[model samples]
Target: MSESTTDAATTASDDDAVAAASSSPGLSRRGLLGLALGGGVAGLAVGVGAGVAGGVALGRARAAEEAQTAYDFFGAHQAGITTPVQEHLHFASFDMMPRTDRDDLISLLQDWSYAASRITQGLEVSATGAVGGDAEEPPDDTGEAQGLPAAGLTITIGFGPSLFENEDGDRYGIADRRPQALERLPPFVGDDLDPAHSQGDLCIQACADDPQVAVHAIRNLSRIAFGRARLRWSQLGFGKTSRTTSAQATPRNLFGFKDGTANILADDAKALEQNVWVAVSDEPGWMAGGSYLVARKIAMLIETWDRVRLSEQDAIIGREKGSGAPLSGGDEFTEPKFSGTAIDANSHVRLAHPDQNDGIRILRRGFNYVDGNNELGRLAAGLFFLSYQRDPQQFIALQKRLSTDLMSEYIRHVGSGIWAVPPGAASGSYVGAGLFA
Candidate 1:
């Protein structure tokens, strides 16, 4: 037979072999489960003890056929702020090592930007990825997410007050460029912050639909920063407490109350530009399109809250738990009647409402977190509060108003951080490139 005919016959034979293998009763459910669980080739080999090669081939084929969701990494503003709130979050704060200089910091940001862009697109960290380099050298990626989908992952970077001017003084030579609005927050009325989790030089907010996908983004980025920066503190969150888009249903907190009823939606460009984005006149031109982020780890006194009467809970929250409506009896989206008799003067909704705060509004993208049971055998659960605003003062002012709310009795503010999130990086450029320029 001619070469062309021989090639056609080989292709037909391969197709038949695949069809036969797929129909074979010997292909066990355990093998398929291992593949579905992202066990990769090795797990498939172990799962199908006698059919190692075939199992590996099957796993690869399944991975190739899997669908993935991706978000654009390059944009006017970094994602995870205005992006629709994801189901899971892996937030990490990092402090630059004492020896890392300005140049080292810049290089690390560039490398992180490249890796973030690729990983968000469902690709490996580098062209020569896990198991691709020399036999002796460490792999580029950790490979825990080897065949996993991107699952709509977004990684957002931020620079804290310490990044620009730490106690050491002007470490990055950009102290003058730091925005005046990026200062450390003043002590609030009820803050019980732990020193270990209060501040950091830099922070990464990674969000995704899958927990592993979120964890993988932070893990790989932390790995890449090994010598330059070290993890200061991290928080894992699930069950998004707020929605950034109108399409998503408002999520509930551990208290079973609908949270973020009046949150700024992503589609509200006017509200976003006026309340979230930093304009050129805001100072430090590098942050023209940026926003300030406030993260508060609010620990809920779950046992105490659970024991409270339902009527008392409703009075404190100022909303009906069942409908998330104002106590005055309107729908969830109705304007809250702060003046109504049903609403208490110190109710949470009354204090948090923009109508009560000189029309000031901030975008909320918080989540409910359950770290574990504390030493007291009580569930250490609470809201991982995240808010983005044009200025840090927005959060400070709002939080000040909340200090007197009746809900304060049920919650204690523990971990806290403030960050300046610069505008998004354009294609072929790294995040915070303008700061370096």
Candidate 2:
């Protein structure tokens, strides 16, 4: 902790004492109030001490809990990357149906807050006390702790537009996904690409030190939360080909980066809206809170890419052969000049001839999966790419250009799926619901 934080703790201890001095039996309330108001001992010293103890306990508790849940949230020691196994799993939401009895759903949804607290990881921000649930008890309103993740594992629950409305416009949640998809999807199943966590339309992601432990915990959570054993997507990662995937559990993106950079962080709010929010917003009352486009592409051919020359490969991706930077370059964010396009006639970008002016940019979040050994006795894996946008056409534009781009020589796409990430639930509710309404 910083000196400033330590100093603050010391100061609060005096406040807590002053506040508690008045009442002995009811002092806990007085102490808490004083801390919040005067930055008292509870708020400052005792609070800081409590926080540390709490955080450590929370972390340990999460680890224990995850031992039972599948899909480890713990950090693995093998590769260079550092992220809870659960954190690496990607998530998005779609629309669903709302409850006729709003209060009941809210109560049950609020019960989920405890579960949320048990699994959310590294949550930096809280979405605001807008969370409504559990009429028996209200959820605590605080900074990052407002929801869960205090424990090692983390939970990310998404809602469709229907979450905000009742038959008369009350707040409640709903479970939803495309109708045709429900039958094929299991309640909680391992993904073809990522076998760590159980997959759900609205996933409760988790992670822990042990993979078996994590998955076990997750499986239990599935039974408790949804009341069903499980039903998940049959295949979750790269579409099957002659190659193998994650049988031994190694991680890599389709591009073959030792670690592919993630675009989860945007430049600003505008970037968030541009990069993630869908353009269409008029809810037909029934579809009121839904989103419009999900661009899913199973990045095929990274296996073939693993076999190419360093120089030949670098020219295609237009980044440092190893650094994952611009060909003309700087770091990941630097701009590359198209002027360097002539460096190699057979280069990937040269043949693709992408220009900042004409070339479209689509945000990318992808990871590589090392299936089993390939024909060469080497691990075979490719990219699992997902992008969200107001319009998927932009992604299509990039693909059209890439069709003839030099990168195509090394990459081959095998599967594609798309769906809209329905809009967030209205104030005082979580998302998903509308399909059944």
Candidate 3:
């Protein structure tokens, strides 16, 4: 039951008594006058004050109760990918333990799937929750999110290229099922990749309107994965840099330019099918409804960018700083007029535009991150670029085209990974279940 209801029930009798006494008709006019003039007045004042306090408490409790929001865990497509982007993100990539075998990995996936489903519903990870397990043994859940709501939590999982064929060679014995487009991304120009943060065998993206809820989802999932998969790297992100739904307003990147203004919206089914989802004829059969994910941790050289002239910045981005409109003049969504305009020929938007790339497009769901000041006193901030496409080449082609863009000077790609997001699990199955079959 909601806390508001409990509070109302607890105070209902007292409120009724106050109303009854105040409304009683048996008292004489002098008695009523005396009641008003004597200590009865103060008593009534106290009663009214108590009622107001109760009402305020109940209102707050009701607001808190109503704050809890949830998303369906089971669907044709995973929740986090195409789900309207949430406010916070906790993304993690894991490497399977060497000692873990195929069966062990499969079992871990099953356990994780079940736990994720329960958690997204604002329930404990398991029925025998945080404290119900044996005292001597560690609890199944971490207990940090014990009283918290789901906050619209959604967990999406993906399989990295290395998961199929790594240095250890087909660790899980599913190398044969690896999609042709799931190979590691080719090095791009100006890439300063950190090997430690670049790749993983598996990845989970947890997102929610509440930071704690997003973190808790990853924490519990990581705990459940203890002996099976070790965390390789993780990135916490806030302030979504892109909008996947029409309901949301376009958000800005650390560069102060509106990002993803021309991004593919979730409602465009034709665009999604053409540019995002992997069709049966497009790749290995297991990836039919899935898509390829390319994650890049691009570190923005904030100190340098800040020093650039505003006009130069506008030219670099090919859009107005205030309105995000093309230099050729129009609203944010207006198509760029490449001919006879101040927009740089090598500007970011012009090169990244679909018209420039043979109508190729990708669904971008990026976020801005600030990791604190660097040792050199520069703000360590950047865009965590996450894009999904029908094929890996879509990203490769775009990156190649942008290699010479003026904006590249202000940003450096520090981490990158490419993963084949498997088709979503059926109600009774786990993610990547098709590969196992």
Task: Give TM-scores for every candidate, taking all chains together and pairing residue i with residue i.
Answer: 0.85, 0.48, 0.84
In model 3, pairs of residues that clash are: none
lDDT of each: 0.78, 0.34, 0.76
Off by over 4 Å in 2: 1-87, 90-118, 121-218, 224-230, 234-264, 279-304, 329-332, 343-361, 374-380, 423-428, 433-437
Candidate 3 TM-score over all chains jointly: 0.84
Tens digits of lDDT, candidate 3, 48-105: 0122255577776754543465655555667777777777888889998887789877
TM-score of 2: 0.48
Report the C-alpha lDDT of model 1 over 1-437, residue by residue, as the tens digit: 01110111111233332332222122123222221332221211001112226558776564333225566566678877877788788898999989678887887787677777777766666655677766576566767677876677788999999999977999889898888888888999889999898889999999887677788788777777766777898888888999887777999999999999899887777898899989888788999888999999999999999999999999999999999999988799988776658899999999999989998999999988887799999998899999999988888889999988999999999999999999988766778999989
The weakest ten consecutive residues by lDDT in model 1 span 1-10
How much is 411 displaced in model 3, in angstroms? 0.5
- Global lDDT for candidate 3? 0.76
Error of 2 at 356 (Å): 4.7
Point to the candidate with the largest lDDT: 1
Error of 2 at 264 (Å): 6.4
**Stretches of candidate 3 exceeding 4 Å from the true structure:** 1-67
